[model samples]
Target: MSTIVVDHLSKIYPVAVKEAGFKGTLTHFFKRTYRQVKAVQDVSFQIESGEVVGFLGANGAGKTTALKMLTGLIHPTSGRVEVAGHIPFQRRSTFLSKVTLVMGQKQQLIWDLPALDSFKINGAVYGISDRALNHRVGELSEMLSLQGKLTQPVRKLSLGERMKAELLAALLHEPNVLFLDEPTLGLDVNAQVAVREFLREYNQRYGATVLLTSHYMADITALCKRVLMIHQGQLIYDGSLDRLVDRFSPCREVKVEFARPYSAHELSVYGDLQDVEKQSARFLVQQEGLTGAIAKILADLQVVDLTVSDPPIEEVIGQLFQAGTVAG
Candidate 1:
């Protein structure tokens, strides 16, 4: 069953008009101008219970705005948002109790106190029973390898350790719906992998529905089977991660190394040459022509090595944004 439903959800911010000159600034006090910037526009998607979904977008693409709406941190200008059978913006205690949002740049822990104290405070806020809280805390600390670090003040721990503590605090109540925005943004590769593994385990153990927004392709590619991609405040695509790649990227990349420098004429014989160097060339060919193009290139030239691959997800998304801008 769908645990989250968003129907035409939209958010708009009114931009204040400010003039540069002194006279213009004085006049603005009497009559001010406002422009409406639509941050999220007519976006709709359904997420089932226990599904881990990725949210992809460029900066100013409204990924964070949409997440805020879902988590009730901000209200949408229009459209319905139901998460876990409750309207999020209401900020109902029961609804809030069952959902958690973890942002990488933001800290909910107390800097002056030990992380364990922060968790204790959160446990109180959620009104978790002492027995239940202890059990949950123990499990999370073990999972995040924070047993010893729990006694350290948040300011004293490393970035990665603080992140783990944040996760543990957020999960103390075992919220059924999780919203993670750039959860591993500044961490090194090892830390990133650790966070990813924890998320995977947390989801499997609790059957929580997770919505993740990240710039790192590896984060989305490793953790999510489905992706919701947006651009310029509009929903661009919603489907399987593989389907997203397939739909937006119909052309395949072909890299060919030659024994000698190749002419444009010979390259054109294979496919559209995307780039060329002294001894090698790369081409973008439609899926249908890939096999024949490779065969012809191998038969005609001294082929040293060749590789074919789908375009990067970031590139596909960039193309989508370009197309949207042109359409508008």
Candidate 2:
């Protein structure tokens, strides 16, 4: 079943326009001129229950605006949005209870208080009984490896620990739908892996639906098999992650180590050389011509080692955005 539905959704903001210098300032003060800016334009997609989907876009690409609308934090300028069978912008209590939004840059826990105290307050707000709250806390803490960190003041805990506590507080009521933005934003490598593991386990345990947005490709690559790509406030591509990669990057990365140093110009005949360092070089060869290219390289050059693999997903997506080739 589809847990979230967005149809022809759009958000337009009326930004004030002003001229240059003192005259423009005086005109703006007296009678402000306004221009319409389309933050999100006619985006439409449906998310099935129990699926973890990646939401991809660059900065100022209307990703946050769309998330705000889906969470009922802000109303959409036009179109329909439903989450967990409830209209999101209506801000109904049952809908609110069924969904949770976690933004890494924002926090709900009080910095001066122990994390446990904040969790208690959240439990009260959600009307969870004390005994039930404690049980839930214990279970989640164990899963997060946050056994004794909750008792410490939030400010005193390490960044990773504090983030885990924030997640604990958000999941206290056992929300059925999660909208996470940059959940692993500023943690070390180990912390990122931990959070990803916890999320996978949580989805398996509860069958919860998740829609995650992150600039970090590792998060998406690790957790999401499907993705929805938005560009310039419009939904462009919605499909399997592997397909997106293959569609945008129709080539294989070939890394070759030569027995002797070779100039970049000397190797240009093999493929599109990306980099050359010492005796090692990287090239992007079309998948259709990979075998032939490899054979020619091996026959023409004194090669020590060679390997072929798909290009990094971040680079593929980055090139798409840079070239503005994504069509709505």
Candidate 3:
């Protein structure tokens, strides 16, 4: 069943516009100008229980705005959103207790106080008994590898440690759905891996539905098999990651080394020459032409070695963004 449902959900903001300089500012002060910005428009998707879906977009693409609406922090400008079987914008206690929103750049932890104190506060807000609070905190702390660090002041901990602590605090209430924005942002490689591993294990252990957004593709690549891509405040892609690649990327990369040196222009007939060196050249060949291109190259040129491979995931996604339209 779908635990999170968004039906034509959209958010629009009326932003004030102003001109530069003295005369323009005086005119603007007398006659104010405003523009209606569609932060999210006609966005709709459904998330099944226990499904971890990646919400992906460049900055200002409305990923965060959609998340805020889903978590009940902000109401949508139009359409409907249901999370955990309750209307999100209503902010009822039942709805609030069933979902948690965690933003990596924002901190819920008290800077000067120990994370334990903050955990207790969260428990209080959720009406969790002391016994349950201790048990839940212990479980989350163990999962995040923060058994001994939870007592330390948040400010005293390392960046990675503080992030782990923040995660533990968020999960202390045992919410069924989590909306995480940039959950692994700014962490070192090791820290990023740690968080990824922990999230995977936590999801498996608890069957929690997670909707995550991150600039680090590693976070999405490792954690989400399905992804939702928003572009220009609209949901452009909602499907498996593999399918997204196949839908948008029609070309594969081919690299070859000739026994003799060849210039890029000389090899242009074979494929779209991407890089050329003294003895090696790379080409982007359409999937349907990959076989014919390789055959023609081998038959006509003195080939030393050759290999064909899929383009990088990042490159494929970049092409999608540049195209600015979803595959029909």
Candidate with the greatest TM-score versus the true structure = 2
Q: In terms of TM-score, which candidate is stronger, 1 or 2? A: 2
**By lDDT, is 1 or 3 better?**
3
Q: What are the runs in model 1 whose C-alpha is more than 4 Å off? A: 17-32, 258-283, 288-303, 325-328
The sequence of per-residue lDDT tens digits that candidate 1 reaches over residues 1-328 is 7999999999999987888999889878888899999999999999999999999888899999999999998989999999999999899999999999999999999998999888888989999988898899889889988789988888999999999999999999889999999999899999999999999999999899999998888999999999888888998788888877776677888998988998887688788787789998988888988899889988989999999998677766676767664221
| lDDT score of residue 127 within candidate 3 | 97
Clash count, candidate 3:
0
For 1-328, candidate 2 gives per-residue lDDT tens digits of 8999999999999999999999999999999999998999999999999999999988888899999999998889999999999999889899999999998999999999999999999999999999999999999999999997888889999999988998999999999999999999998999999999999999999999999999889999999999998888888889999988878887899999999999999998899898999999999898899999999999999999999998888978887777656653
State how far residue 56 of model 2 sits from its true place (Å). 1.4
How does candidate 3 score on lDDT? 0.91
By lDDT, the best candidate is 2
- Candidate 2 residue-wise lDDT at 130: 98
Clash count list over all predictions: 0, 0, 0
TM-score, one value per model:
0.85, 0.89, 0.88
TM-score of 2: 0.89
RMSD of each: 3.7, 2.9, 2.9
